[model samples]
Every structure is written in C-alpha cells, then in structure tokens.
Target: MSRYSKGISLLENLLFFWCGLSLILSIGGDNLVIPSWLQVAGRMHPLMLHFPIVLLLLAIALLWMKEESWRGFGKNLLLIGANFTGITVVAGLLLASEDYEGDALAWHKWLGVVSLGFSVFIYFFLDQVANLFRLAGSGLAVLILLTGHFGANLTHGEDFLFGPLMPKEDKMIALEEAEVFRDLVQPIFESKCIACHKEGKIKGELRMDHLEGLQKGGKSGPFILAGNLDESLLIQRIHLPMENEEHMPPKNKLQLTEEEIEILRLWVMSGASFEQKVMELPQEEPLFQLASNKFTTEKTYSFAAADEDEVKELNNFFRKVKPIFPGSPALEVAYFGASTFDASSLSDLKNIKEQVVKINLNRMPLENVDLSFLSDFQNLEEAQLNFTGLKSGQLEGLSKIQSLKSLAVSGNPFGEEGLENLKKLTQLKRLFIWQSGISESGREELKKALSTVQIDFGFDDKGIIYPLNSPKIDFDKVMFQGTTEVKITHPISSVEIRYTLDGTEPDSINSPVYKEAISLTKTSQIRAKAFAKGWIGSEETKTLLFREGMKPKSYKLTDEPHKSYKAKGATTLFDGVKGKANHTSGEWLGYTDSPLEIEIFLEKDQKPKAVELSLLLHEGAYIFPPETVEIWTGNAGTWSKVTIPPTPQSTKTEEIRYGLLAFDLPQGSFDQVKIKLKPIGKLPSWHQGAGSKGWVFVDEIVLN
Candidate 1:
C-alpha cells in the first residue's frame, strides 16, 4: 500500500535517458560509416555491456513494480543479472585486451561493476530498499547517468555526452567519375598496395580487384572517404610502419615509398571518392589456372595480397622474375629466363623444390650462385646454359645429378676440359657441347668414356657420325594349305620378325622362320615387322592367305550325289571373277557349299605345289572330256587361272566319262588354284547333296 517516497522527477529523467540511448544505438548502427577499428571498439564494448545493463534494469524494475505478494520473481531477476555480470566482465576483458592503453577504459569498466553491485545489493534486501525506494532509485539513476557519460566520452569525445551526435556532411566521390578511380587511384594501388593487403588468398579475406572490394575490405574497413584525407583510415594506416598494427600494407611487403604515400593521401583528400568510371586492368589469367593448362608449366604457390598499392608494386617485381616451366610424368621445372641473377633474385629460387627438371642459367650471374644450390635439385633431368659464367667447378656440380637425361652447356666457360664427372649420369641421352669449353679431343674422350650416350653438336664428317637413317624391309607375303598354318615370306632377309598370324605383330623371342607347305583354314593374315638394331622396321609385309591343295577335313554337302558332281545351270564359271579363267592355266575347283571341308596338315609356312590330286569318278555316265583344267591364284577375283591341254591320256579320255585322275595345278606354294569341272550335260541323276543322281564319284584325294 505504501510506494517508496520522494523524487518522481529523477526517475522519469533516467527512464527517458535509457530510451534515448537505445534509439541512437539502433539508428547509428545502420547509417554510420565509422572507421573500422573504432566501429569494432564501439560495437563490441556496447554489446559486452548490454546484457548486464538490460538485465539489471529489468531486475530493478521488478522491485519497483513487483509487489512482495508476487513472491520470488523479483529475486530471480536480480540473480539472473548477477550471473550475467560475470559474463559481461569476461567480454569486457576481451574487448579491452586489444590496444586499450589508456586508464580511462579501466575506470569506466570498474565503475560498471560498482553499479552492478549496487543493483544486486538492492535486490537481495528487497524490503529495506523498497521502503527507501526514491532515495535508492536516485542513487541508481546517478550510477546509470555516470556510466552513460563515461561510455559516451570513450566513444565520441566528452562533448558527445551532451546531445544527439550529428556528423559533418561527407562530400562523396561523384558517381559519374568512378573511372578516375582506375588511373589516378588503382595504378597506385596495383603498384604499391596489393602484396599483403588485397590478396584474399592468404590469412584474411582481403582482395583489391575492384573499388567495391576495397570499399568492403578484410581485417580493416573502407580505408578512405570523400574529401577527408585527414579523417581517412587509409591515410592513417600509411602513416604506420613495420611496428604499427595498422601499417599500410605490411612492411615485409615493400612499403609504399614516401612519394607514393603522398599520392594516396592527396587522392583521399580529393574526396577519396571513386569516379563512377574507372579503367579496369586487363583481366589477367589466374596464375594457378594458367600454369595448369600446359603439362610442363606448373604453379607452385601464389602469394595474393589485398592492399592495392602493394599488389600493383608486386606485379612489377613478379613480371621480372623468370617463370619456371615445370613438367609432369618427368616432373621437372625449367627456369628459362636468361636474365642476370643476383643474390636476392636467386634467393627467391630457394623456395622452389627439387622437382625442377631444367634451368636456363644463360647470361646470368652464375658465378655468384653457390654451386651447392644445384645439389638440392635431385630430379634435374635436363638443363641448358647457353651463355653464362659457369666454370669447371659448376660443371662438377651439374654432373652430380643422376637423373640428367639431356644437357647443353653451349656458350659457357665451364672449364677448358670435358665434364669428367658427367660419366655419373649414365641415363643421359642427348648432350650438346658445341660451344662449351670442351675441346674436340676432349669431346671425343667423353664419347669414348660414355659410348652409349648420343652426344650431338650437329653432323661431323670425320668423327663417328650416328646414322640417323635406317633401312626398310618388305616381307613379300605367304599362302598355305588346310590347317591354320600360314606361310609368310619377307623379301628382306637376315632381319628377324616376331609375327603372329593371328594379326598381331611378332614380339615373341621365338618367332619361327616361315617354312614352306603350311596348312590353313578360315580367313587370316600374317603380320610381321622387320627389326634390326635400333631401327624398328614398320610392318614390312602382309600376306593374303588361301586354302590350297586342301583335303576336305569337314563338310556338309548342300547338293546331292557328291562324287564328280559337275556343276550345272552354270551361267558361266568364274563370270564375275576379276581375271579371265584361262583353261590353259592350271587351277583347282573352289566350292560354294560342301559336304566335306578340307583340313590338311603342312609345315605352317610358305606354300606347297606339285600335289597329285586324285578323284574316283563313277565312270558310267555322260562323258566329261578333258575339261578346262584351270589354276586360280585366288586373287580378289580368279584373275590367274591356267588351263590343262589334253594329251593322249589312256582309256577314259574319250570313252566313258567320270574316272579319277592324279592331277594337279603345278605351281609355287603362294598359289591357290580353284579347279572347275563344268558338266558336259546336266549333271547325271546321281548328284549327291542335291537329292539327284546327277553327280559322279570323287574320293581318295591325295595332295603330294
């Protein structure tokens, strides 16, 4: 029933102050573009204080408004604020842990603890404080007022505590003139800014590729503002050096020269604002992506920077350093720039690992380079030093690389003698010593010492000249009989070929020499490669195979009455055949459908001729006179078929027909003759597979 007495005016004032402070905090958070370091200090300090302040206020309000009848809720509120005060203290410590040198910060933070204690004490003794409410509330009000004043002074100077703080109107860069940003500004950044500050691919998310990116910086905020160089963070940073935390671009990254720093300051004072138009640097391919395209060029590392001034400066230095082209499979790196090397420049090379395969130390300060540096490049496979001061001692170092495959020391004075130590590089293949200090006699000595290595200075008339030319061989061809043995003959002799008649080149150590009389079946070819010394002859010959003098190993007669079954209804035998089937030329008959297929065994190579082919004919049929006995070479068509002229053969020549004769198309092993026995009349009715008797008897075929 009794409200704590006195001071309604003071309580209303404190409530209004709290309301005002909250409103400014919310609004300022959105519109204010403050220095990043200052803003971080501002936000972090307030955030650390807020929970305790709000909770304590709520706890106080619990007592001011809550009745004792409401029991423990007021006490609970006070306890919650007390627990959170510890958290507030921890956060406050962290915020102050960074660059808070002044004691004002210390005083302000301790005073906050004092106010929190007062709030807690009042909460614990609710009845007594409630009875003296107005007096206690006045003390609380004074505490709050002092805390706010102190915080405001820390952030915006003492005058800021008096009223709503308004900023001076900022003159921003004209929207239309951003392009001026590139020429007047970006070049300065590229030349002196990006090495450590702008490259995002480092410890921080920093990049200096654009104005917008610079505006939204990493680890730091927008470094400049329009027309206020003195107020710009960028200007402030440039004023710092190696020891300062806010140093422009770190000092290890070449600091901006004094004159360059002055340009940046002037640019900032000229509204530090970017023109709407800016010249964008040509988009260079990313070093990593570019190096990955070719097999030999590899990008090992890219140290990207964020500060525009540093990055721009770094680009100049980067362009001068020789790009090392690296290789894969062989995994080597080649330093191809012949520019003079200095200690500092060579020091950069120490960063490159030993995977370097080649280096062009031509026209460089090779004399100053420690030869011991070469020892680390264990995988150096090739090197070229056309013009340099490398001498005998250096050659000794170079010779120690075991993986060296090709080397050229032309135009360098690597001593007056040949590289005696070079014999250690047994894997070396091509060596060029045209302009090195090695004399002709010395080179000859090296050749004798390393005979297998192909050393070249170009063609020499009297010296041991390597014959780059190799002779070509032609394996003529092969043909064989019934079995799968194909006869192959290469016109070029002494050159051995490992051939597989199965169509693969011969690689077996025991590729048999093609012998004569091979039996074969099915379509096949003999593929061979004539190889001699280092000259690998191309596939020298391919032989077209044919089944010749083959006894039927298997067959299913498609026509009836098989023996001496002279073909009938023949438009003309061998009509579409490419060549005229001359009856005078000896040839054998090839079958379309058969009851028996010939499977013969022969020496699986070359060909066999002079076979006596005997057939048992019925001899009781329409006469078959000495028909045209033709020979077919089995060309694409029957181009070469010879005929047999009848002589005074015994009985069956003119009398009864169908009698067997020991016959042959006498020829070489490469020949395939298809004999045709055309019917004198429609075949006699005894034809076998054709369900007719129109055929004569044929059996006991002996191919000798």
Candidate 2:
C-alpha cells in the first residue's frame, strides 16, 4: 500500500475505536466515574465540535460540486471530517456524563451520535453508492442542522433558536392583578438559575423549576427560611463570594444581577407568599417600585432633556432637580430642607416645565396658591404634594395639568370639594388620599367617575392605632469643635417628637418635646421617639453626640487593609466625617486576615481624656466587632500599655449597626497613641460562615 493509503487506514481504525468508546460511555450514564483529566477534555467539546461542523459542510458542498475533478478531493475531505466527527462524539458523551440533562440535551446528544454515524457510513460507501451519494449527503446535512439546533438550545437556553419568530406572551401584568411569586419571583429563577437545577439535571439534588421542589429543597435544607434571609440556604449560597466554590451558577454561568437578588430578598422578607398580589401590600412599600418595572410597561417621554447649565443652576442643598433615570430627559424635581421651602420653590421649577415630569413637595409648608404653579408643567405625570398644608378646594388648581397621571394629596385636609376637582383630570390613573379629609362616601363618588383609577386611601383606620415611624435626626456634623445643632423632624404634622439627652428612653409625657433644633455641647446619648393622638408610640432611635477634642495631626497603619475596602488610607480615621452603617460605603477600612495596628500623633498641647473607635457590625456579612482592643500611650519611642476591659459582645442582628468602643485613659500628657484591634479569627457557630475568617470594619477614631 502507498504511504498516504497507510495513513488513511490508521485514521479510519482510530475513528472506529472512538465511535465504540462513545457508545460504551453513553450506556454507562451516571454510573461512570469521570476522572479530573478526562473531564477537562470533555469541556473542550463545545469548542471542538464547531470545527467538525464547518469541515463537514465544506466537504458536502465539494462532493456535490458540478465539476468532476473536485470529487476526488471531496472524498479525502469526507474521511478527515468523519474522523473529527467521531472524536467530537466521544467528547460529547463524556460531557453528557457531567451535570447535563433535560430534553434539549437529550436530543442534541442522540442527534450528534447519529450525525457521526452517517458521516462514517457515507465516506466508506462513496464509490459503491455513486447514484445515492447526493441523497446520502443531503440526509447528513439535515442531521447536522438538527444536531446544531438542539446543541445551541442546550448551551444558550430554551427557545434560543426560534424564540424571535415564536409568538410571545404578554408580560405586562397590571399592578392590581400581578401575583408576587408567579409574576416576579419565578421568572427570575427561570432566567438566571434552573439550568442545572431542573427536573433531570438536579445539581445538589435541588430542583428550582417548580414551587414544590424549591420548598422541598435538597441535601442542604429548605430553599428559603420564609421570613429569614440569613438562614436560607439559597440566599446563603448566592451571597457567597464569586470565587467561592459554593457560589451559585458555578461562576462560569450567568450570575444573578443585583436587582434580581433584591427581588428575591423582598419576596423572602414578605413571607415568600405565593398568593400575595402586588396591590395587597402597602402602596408605599419599596417592593412596589421594583415590581412596577416588571409588571407594567415603562413610560417614555418625548421631550428632550433640559439644559445642563439650567439644571445645575437650579440645584441647591435644599432643592434637587434631576432626570428620573440615567440619560432620561424626564425630570423629577424635589424640594428638601422643609424649613427653607418657600412659595417660589414651586414657581422656580417652571424654567424646565417641558422636562418636569414629576414633582415632590411632600411635607413642605405649601399653601393653596402654590398649587397653581404646577399648571404650567405641561408634562407633569406625578405630583407628591402630601402633607403640604393644602386644604379643601385647593386641588382644583391641579386639574389644568392635562398630563397628570398620579396625584398624591395624602395627609392634607382636602375634603369632598378637593376630591371632586380631581375627577376633571381624565388622565389620572392613581389618587393617594390617605389620611385626607375625604369621607368614604365622597371617595366612592369620585371612584365612580374615574372608574379605571387605582385610589389608595391608605390603611383604613378601622380604630386600629398603628405605631409611628422613628423621627429622623439631622445634624450638620457628628464631630464638632463647638456646639452642634441637632434637628429632629417627622413627616406628619400631627406627630410629636419627644427626646431625652440621657441614655433613657423617651416617653410621650416625661420627655421634652422637640420644637426646634437642640443645642449640644458635650458627649451625650440621645434617644428619641414619635407619638400621635390615636396611634401607638414609635420605637426609640438612639445616637451619640461627640464633642471633638484633640485632633490627630497624622496617622499610619502598620498592617494594610483588604485591597477592596481600603478607604482613603489612614486619613479616613480622622477626616471628621463618620461612615454610614453600610460597610461597603468606601468610608470604612475593612480587615479580614490581619489585626489593625494604627498609630496616631496628636497636637503637642492637646491631651485627650478618652478615645473612641467607630466600627460596624453586620453578622449577616460575617463582620463582627473586634475580639480584643488594646491601647498604648507613648512619646519619643517610650510606651506604656493601658489596661482595657474585655471587648463587649456585639448586640447586632442581621441588620447593620454603627457602634463605638470607648476606652478611658489615665491622667497623662501623651502625644502619640497606638490602637490595636484583632478581628474574630473564626465566625461563631451560629453564623453562616462558621469556621471561616471574619471581617472588622472601622470608619473613624474619635478622641475626646
């Protein structure tokens, strides 16, 4: 035999061997133990299969070419394509033994084997079946197309091939009729999860394709803890770092987005109800804003954005005017600092009347005349004038804005006359009259006139006294050289804010009522609450008042913080700005594997009586307070260690908390101080990441 003929014989023998090996592995199914080395080869099936597909297509085209001379070259191409096809079939069988199943995978696997069989058969009989050569080539081409179609579906997701041509179901569910789980939560799973956790391929033995399987769970536990996100196995897996072996979607697949994860959190927080509708929850619920995007078609405005200079000039510390979303032309204007809100605040917004689509004047001292300014905003779709001191017959001024769709007049004393005028706004779809002066009968009359409107007459009193929310405390600065003015405000006009300087809780009658901003000169623990005539008292809110003492001239960290959370370096500790409770807010310096050893130099003449280290506690994220805090005072390289009490145990739950660890110092004049904080070596037994390293996040250090 010729040299080329011998090489061709050897390749054909290898092809036969691969075809048999693929058959045996396919029969082995789940019983086969694929080694690590073989699994790596199997993963190359996706990349290698494409080469054989192109080779076969070209070989088939050459074989059927009208020219006779190319038929000889086509015979050699067919043999080479058939050899690679056999190799691909073997790799595919190995891949199938992994976490792959469902109808799409099954069809793709069988059709791939069939396509390889056809290529091998046609190449051997090319000369014997000359008349049938074209017929067999056509059949093999059809098989390749079908095999590729199913393979694409397996890799890309269901309906990937014909999804664009298929008739789509309308997904725009009305807010009143949208079910929480069916309309919102389930779709999230189908899109991001469910590939490996479906019926046939049950990774971790967990099936998330249906409700019952989710509740039943798999090897770990229940999919969700119902009202608890910390204990839920599914949430725990998702919150794991992307590089973690236990992270969901295997890090290689499409991972869940932040918005999708938030929807899951809302679902679990609201009892993971399967029967709850969107309208059944409170109208002001944060979930409604998220669900609105999913359930209804997003509104688009036709007007162009306002001039950048005009928008920038209008924005002040108290007033904000910006687009509803990024790059959107529609503007949502809001007025803050209610004490400075004047009548001109509404009139000043007319500079961008064409772009102003939403206005929020909630809790402002707005009068009836101020409502007339809204008439010129030709594109206004939403008006939040709740608690604006509007009275009866004032809403008539808003009827002229023909584009108004949502009107929130809640907390106003607008009775039948005010609601009667709202009937003239034919475009109005939602009317918020909660706690307004309108009676039930008057609301019925208006509802009949605007039959399609969704009227939210918030929480029917029904003689039930719901607890008020805690008063919001606003201060210019947390650390101050002189006295700082602390202002406490509540949204409702009738609600009273009572506060105390001591650590004791505030009561309705015993505590001093907050009429104006309170002046503070020293360190004090302030606890405040809200009370109304017919409502239960609100929970007490606590905060610390710090009088700045010796300021640090400079500071340095002996140990580096984690790369991801190293806030502006050591300067963050004495920048005079405190971080929020969220540890990821760039203001915090996070340490995971090392102790925080910081040395600070105070002014020469200043002597601090005590030192406070501000830290965050969020057990859900494995951020715990320091296990031990050591303080040493020194000057000119001479140091004296100060004895400190054992670090107090953290009283935090799943929620984020900002707390201080204060240490009193002995009477001495020390210019240099060293603080050492050791993070928890291992998480507590009750934590989700037990036996793993914990994190310590410190934002600022106060010397008083």
Candidate 3:
C-alpha cells in the first residue's frame, strides 16, 4: 500500500477500536467512577452530543443525492460522522459512570451505543455495501432523536417540558375535604420516598406508588402493619439516625421533617385507613392539629429575624428563647423555675420584642405592676399567665398586642371584669379562665361579645346539686367457697346505695335501698350506684361474687412480676381484695415484655362455671389491657386450652379506666387451672411511646 493510504487505514482502524470500547463502557458504567478531572469532560457530554447529530444528518443528506461526486463526498462525510459519534458516546459513558441510574439513563445508554455501532459500520463499508449504508444512516438519524430526548430528561426532570404548561393546584387542602391516606400521607411519600421506591425503580424491592404495593411490602417485609407502627419497616427506617445505613433517603437525598415523620407515624397508628377523612379524627387529638396546620394556608410574616447575639444574651437559666421551628425567624420566649423569675427577666426580652411571637409566664410570681412591660411586644401571637397574681385592670395594657391569637390566664385572680380588656384582641382564637372568678353567666356574655373566640370556663360543677362519686364495696372478699355477706358504702353521709342482684343496672326509684350487709347464695353480679338528694347519680359499679370455689393450695408463675408492682407472692392473684384505681398501689401485679402464666392448684376437683380476671387499662402510664387470655383446665402434662377471650381494641391515651376479662369454663373441673395473659408485644402506633413494649396489670383472678 502507498504511505498516504496506510496512514488513512490506520486512523480508520483506531476509530473503530475506540467505538467498541465506548459501547462496552456504556453498558456497565453504572457502578464505575471517573477521576475528578475526567468528570469535567463528562459534564461536557451535553455540548459534545450535538456534534454527532449535525455531522450524521449532513452525511445522510449527501448520500441521498444521485451524483457520483456527492456519493464520493458522502463516504468522506461518513468517516467524519463516525469520528464525532465515537467522541459523543465516550463522553456519555463517562457521565453515566458518575452514579446515575434509572429508566432515562438506561434508554439513553443503549441508544447511544447503537448509534455509535452503526456509524462505525457505515464509515468502513459504505462503498462495498451502499444500500445497507443508506439504511443504517436512516436508522442512526432516528436513534439520535431518541437519544437526545432521553438525555434531556435525565439532565432536566421527567416533567421538565410539560410541567410549566400544567395547571397548578393549591398545595393546601381543606381539612374536611382531605383524605387521610391519599391526600395527606401519599404526598409525603411522593416527595421524600417515591424517588427510589416507585415502580421500575424499587431500590429495596419496595414500590410505594399504589396502596396495594405498600400493603404487599418489600424484600425486607411489609412497609406498614396497620395499627402497629413499631413493626412497620417504613417507620423504623425513617426514625433511624441520619448516619445509620438504614436511614430513609440514604442521607444523600432529602430527609423527612419532624412534622412529616410525626404525621406518618400517626396515620399508620390510626389503622392506616385509606378512606378516613381528616375531620373524622378527634378534634382534641394532636393529629387533628397537625392535619389542620398542614391543610390551612398560613399567613406570611415580614418581620426580620432577631440578632443572634441579642437573642443569646436574652436567654438565661430562668428564661429560654428559641425559634418556633428550625430555620424560622419567629421566636418563642418562656420563663421557667418560678423562684428565679422577677420583673428584671422581662427587661432582658425587650431587645427582641419585635421578633418574639410567643411568651409563657406560666406559674410565675409576676404582680400587676409587671403587666406594663408586655405592651412593647406588639408581635406576640400567644401568651400564658396561668396561676399568675394579675388582677382585673392589670391586663388593659395587653390590648396593644394586636397579633395575639391565644391567651391563658387560668387559675389567676382575674375576675369577670378582667375579660373586658381582652375584647380589644380581635385576633384571639381561644381564652382560658378555669378556676378564676368568671361565672357561667359572665362567660356566656363574653362569648356573645367575642363571637369567634372559644371561651373555656372549665367543667361546670356549681349549684346546690353536686355530682356523686361511684359507690365503693366495703367487703374485702368478693369470692368465697360458701355464702358471704357483701356491703356497699358511699363517701358522703347523705348519699344512699341502691342494689340489684341480677346483671341489670340499678336506678333510684325501683331498686331496693341497702340498709346492711346482703347475703349471697350463689354466683351473682351485684351492681350498685350512689344517690343523693340534690345531686346527679354516680356511675354504676359492679362486682361478681363466686360462692362455691375454694382458695388454691399452691400456685406458680411462668414469668416473674415486675419488681415495682410485685405483691406478696403468686397467691396475690387469688387474693379476694380488689386493687385501687392507681396501678402503682402495690396491690396489682405488673408484667412487661412477656405474658403472665399462672398455674393454680385447687384444694379439690370442683366444677367451676366461669373464670374472671380484673385488669387496669391506663394508656398514659403505658399500661394496656392484655392482648389475649387463655385458660387451661388439665394438669401440667395434659393441659388443654378451654377458651381464649377476644382481644380488646387498644385504647387512646385519653381513656384511663378498669375492666374485667371473663372466660367461660367447661362443664368438667380439674385439680389445676392455668391462666395465660399476653400483653401487647409493642405499644400501638397511636401511643406516644409507640415502638416500646407495653405493661399489663392484674390485681385478682376468681374461679366460679
């Protein structure tokens, strides 16, 4: 070959080799990383990509002409097109190696590879295969358009083109119209979780686009467990520390806010129902407030942030100053440790008066003279003076705080006349006057004046008619082998106890009055209620009496009771005495993290009709009713489950009451009766301490 021809052939061979390498790298470049300097060249792929489009189209146009000269020039143009295609594909591969993956990346990758391969084929064989070269050129042109479209999508977002043209909807929704799952919860997943967990992009094999997908769960397990938040992997991952490997969004992506996390936890705790509405939740519930805040558009404040140094100086041991939310300029100043509070504490906050939005002086010893200092805080949105010594006229200067939304002066000496000063605060939404001198008539008049405000005068217990307390049973032993005398007593001297032997409730007019101890002959449910001359009747109290079963001779427990609530011994379970309202009274036995198993050895084999177990359910104390209870009649080796009572629904924190779980026994009796009480493995999601283990308290167990 001639020297000039050899040089041209060598360049062609090198170009073909470069195109092959680019194709290989593009296919497997998802896990690769390039050096920092190469990343700059990688970023230039967008600019370099245009060269192949222009050159390839020009070559195709030249090939389309019928002249011999155009055909000759087209072959040379194809060589140039091949060179630019190699450069574009290689640059795209470099960019792909920088941690990009998804449907857009996949489509762009394979198309660029195909275009490069076809360009190299035409560059070498255009003269030998002219018809095939024309077909490849047309195919290359189509690939170029598709490759560019997907590349644009990867650079910008999927909706970049259509996003601006789409009609924008209001971000906030009315609470009454908002759906709990679809409207409130799903939006959070779309923003923070759907990027990696949507269809075609399941990072952990978890897809969150549809309700069915979330219900089915991922590789690890189900994302949610309805009322159980602790068992839900979705909640566990979100609560993980940011530095932990399992944290959601992987630390590199956007993290869920505290409010968002709380909302998700609450929604999952609330049975994760897709059909429930925001208004369906209790008005006093925290979830209701969170939902209201989310759906209601808040007004923007134009006030500038307080100086950092001034805010720092204002904070002391007695007074604390902080932002209402992270990165927000609005400030909340509260006084603590009443002994350290004085008139001078108010002066420290004067520098940041304009920035302060909330002030709490609860339980402080401020006098009426100190009320003047609050006049400067014109931007205050909430103020609490509960239990303060401020009198009627002292609050006149507070009327200047026009932005106040809530004011609490409960337990103060401020009387009915003091409410007139609050009339000037037109923006006030709530006012509290519990334990103050404000009468019911005065509260009604104030409510009429401030029509929009919710005035709370506390629970009404006034007038000659007082509410009666539930009657108490005076007898210590409720269950006896033979007939026993039962007596009921009332706290007030004027009150009388009405009695009934059947399971029906007692009323004042028909039920017979109890003058002394009443004898019981058999198993009976005795119900009683207190009646007073000028008072509302108390709630009915009932107790079951078993007259035929003897006390157990010996007993054993599978799980030891918690030390704090352990009674004398396992015999405590059979003790005839009932526990008090307080679970911590040492009368009840508490079990945590495990179920309570008690095996009682009866004195002799006697036919027992039923078994009753008394329990306490106090959600605030993290005490929940037993999830399940099983009773067995046979001895250790031949024991059989006689019955399992249905588990009660978990109660909310607002309910603090006591109840009994009764299980019906079989007709036959045995020497031993085994009881198994299983506590909730983890507190329900609605609980504030939701993922922790719960407690079960039992005071007495009776067999009849």
lDDT of each: 0.46, 0.80, 0.76
Q: Which stretches of candidate 1 lie over 4 Å from their true place?
A: 1-46, 69-71, 155-264, 267-704
Better of 1 and 3 by TM-score: 3
Misplaced by over 4 Å in model 2 are 1-81, 84-415, 421-502, 506-522, 525-545, 556-599, 602-609, 613-661, 665-701
Better of 2 and 3 by TM-score: 2
lDDT string for model 3 (394-474, tens) is 777777777887898888876777768756656788888788887778777778888988878788665556679999876
TM-score, cand. 1 vs. native: 0.21
Best by TM-score: 2
The top-ranked prediction according to lDDT is: 2
In every candidate, how many clashes are there? 103, 0, 0
Model 3: ten consecutive residues of lowest lDDT: 292-301
- Runs of candidate 3 with Cα error greater than 4 angstroms are 1-183, 186-193, 196-412, 416-453, 458-496, 501-503, 519-526, 530-578, 586-610, 618-628, 643-658, 662-664, 667-671, 678-696
RMSD of each: 33.2, 13.5, 18.2
Supply candidate 3's per-residue lDDT for 49: 81
Candidate 1 Cα deviation (angstroms), residue 124: 2.7
Better of 2 and 3 by lDDT: 2
Q: Could you tell me which 10 consecutive residues in candidate 2 have the lowest summed lDDT? A: 293-302
State which candidate, 1 or 2, has the greater TM-score.
2
